[model samples]
Target: MSERIYSDYLNEYCKDSSIFLVKESEGRVKNFLNLDQEIPDQYRWRFSDLNSIVKQVRSENTRQGLNKIYWTDQSRNIEAYIIMTWWRGNELVRSCLNGLNRREVIVPAIAARSLLELSTVFLLNANTLEKNFKKIMFPPETIVISTDIENLVAKMIWGTRYQPKDELLTQTNIMTALKKLAKSPGTKDLMPTYDFLCDIAHPSFIGNTSYWSHIEVINPDGSERRLMSRLTDRQYNTEITDKTLWALAWSSTCIYNAFIIMRDAYSGLLKKI
Candidate 1:
């Protein structure tokens, strides 16, 4: 059968189940093939490595889900889907407990700890990627590490909130953390990535007049749904100085500590792994 005919047949077969899934899966495969065709010999190898990792992770997850999945193309074979059992449920439970008193001191502290764990993971990944990958387009820098942690903290805190205005205002905290990191002796060497980080931290036009601040997933079949909120005024300005970097780092560390405590309560889950 022709490629088009094969795709059409698959579409018809899976239409009742998940048309979107079929299309997205096929599209990813096609995009990867196109990249292999267009990229240089040297760069093609890197893309291949990345594509393999993507496929491996997806396959692992699929299998874990107990789904009888199949893939038509050999290069596009679907693998197991491994889902982490300990999800946001643990976080929500912790939040509920922490909401008992008006003081609400523990909840924020827990949030800070989670932020730190995430930052440390990113920092480790950055170092690993730097060492493993050759001819990297973006070199690893301490400034990048500081900026990334700041962004992560911003997302964790503001992204969880339901207010767009509040989310947009997170820039202040982000900037503060950056400045603190830059000033610290440990992070002083990352001064070079400082300017670049600042540029990305500034705000820009959101392009929509309507305050589409929140998102919802509604299942027509009366299934459970998930909702996510959106942040407005999304723009980055690149004028970060050493002072700004230091401040941002300090703010991030405070939040990171909070996140860690909350995560520690669920440390049993970590021990399982």
Candidate 2:
């Protein structure tokens, strides 16, 4: 299927979800921005990284449109748009993450869409970073760690290069890589949740459960009738369930943290002009 706008997603998924639960998630987003803002040695590593990119982008551009991205033309500013999309994806996921947490009833419905966006962002950012690794100046360990994982995943999933499917945007490829990463010894605990969330996020039968219907009647011919209906009793005016609320906060935090390096590169692009 092709991509969809946000409202379409909301209308379909949020109808049976909890508004109060979604509202509760907004309060948690800010803490994701900074864990130790009051401390002497703050943990604002992402902030510093973003600032570096900003400085670089500013210095490189003699043209006023260093910041320009090919939003419509697609031909102009390809690199800029790739980087911008990386940021834009994060920004939207952040907002969507926040909006869904505090307002929707069935949080996973919204989560599926957010994860879809993040998955794309992941592919784009990783590929773009690799393409411009030298300019990004990422730490040797940082680069090595991700590449190592990709290589391991590729080998395991496809039996080495014989049946290569290394396309970054391929959902199976990304899923294999992410599942492997999440299953690593240190991350084992989250394996189930990660896989479950992957199901919700991926374009699969499970993700569309938001549109599930009631089977109230059997026709005279004994054919089943799956009528369009809300899971009304499941609705809530109460807080979002603990698990969902935490997931929203966690995903938003994850995206924000992930963008530090990429944002730095984006800023560098502006400077390089």
Candidate 3:
């Protein structure tokens, strides 16, 4: 198979000023990608706009050049194609992680702690500002997680996968860790961060992966292979109460400690290396 070149696709999709290419330093690219939320709109355009631009570019490309090109639309609602940059050396790190078959790799303990701390700072700032000055009051309505929140988590997980010897950390583990950290006497200020993780870790908020199975018999001995069909449901049931809050707090703590242990192990290996 031929190697997939990102630049080739860029050339095909990026025709006019609609797609702006920003050059970023290697470290900055990783940092931007690992942030807990999507880069603000000031950083990128909406995905809808990007798609419109791509469609226009493709039509123009087809008429000018008869080159057969295949491309995949990996953009999400929170992503903007206008702010894309080519990170030449980053693919090696991605390739290394891909070989390990891990998803949402664990961040270093220090990094994780720092992230929580930063989140706490943001929440505290917002809380303080809101308390000091009354903002426009909005009526209570259904609380929906913003696309920014989902994209932020996805980017953080995606970037962490490239960390050396990173372990896959599930949403459950992350919640457990945050809860533990929150309960610590010294971590009172980080309560908001703990709550945020708990929200993401709730089973109802997580994606489901159950499906139907199909069997294919290959031998007279009755050996068979099972094929599963993908299915999706839109139903959601959530119960948020004092009891649930207490449970989430406890689970967060467990996850925090688990992450600490993993970090220590990784550090030990790094020392030897």
Which candidate has the top score in lDDT?
2
Tens-digit lDDT track for model 1 on 11-68?
A: 3433453323333333332332332343233311112234665665576543422111
lDDT of 3 by residue, 1-273 (tens): 133322332223223323122121122323433431342435543333456756655674432121111111122321221122111112222332232122121221112333443333222322332332232222333221224333332343342323524333222234454455567575653565335334444443321212323465567877877554432221121111111222222223323332334333323322321
- Looking at model 1, residue 143 earns an lDDT score of 13
Listed per model in order, the count of residue pairs whose N, CA or C atoms clash below 3 Å is 56, 25, 12
- How much does candidate 1 score in TM-score? 0.19
Instruction: Score candidate 3 by TM-score against the native.
Output: 0.19
Ranking by TM-score: 2, 1, 3
**TM-scores of all candidate predictions against the true structure:** 0.19, 0.38, 0.19
Model 2 stretches astray by more than 4 angstroms: 1-28, 31-103, 106-113, 116-172, 183-190, 198-243, 265-273
True-structure lDDT of candidate 1: 0.31
Error of 2 at 66 (Å): 20
Q: lDDT per residue, candidate 2, 45-144, as tens digits?
A: 2222336546655665433333232111111223333334345444554555545534444554355345444544444444455356334333322211
**Candidate 1 lowest-lDDT run of ten:** 77-86
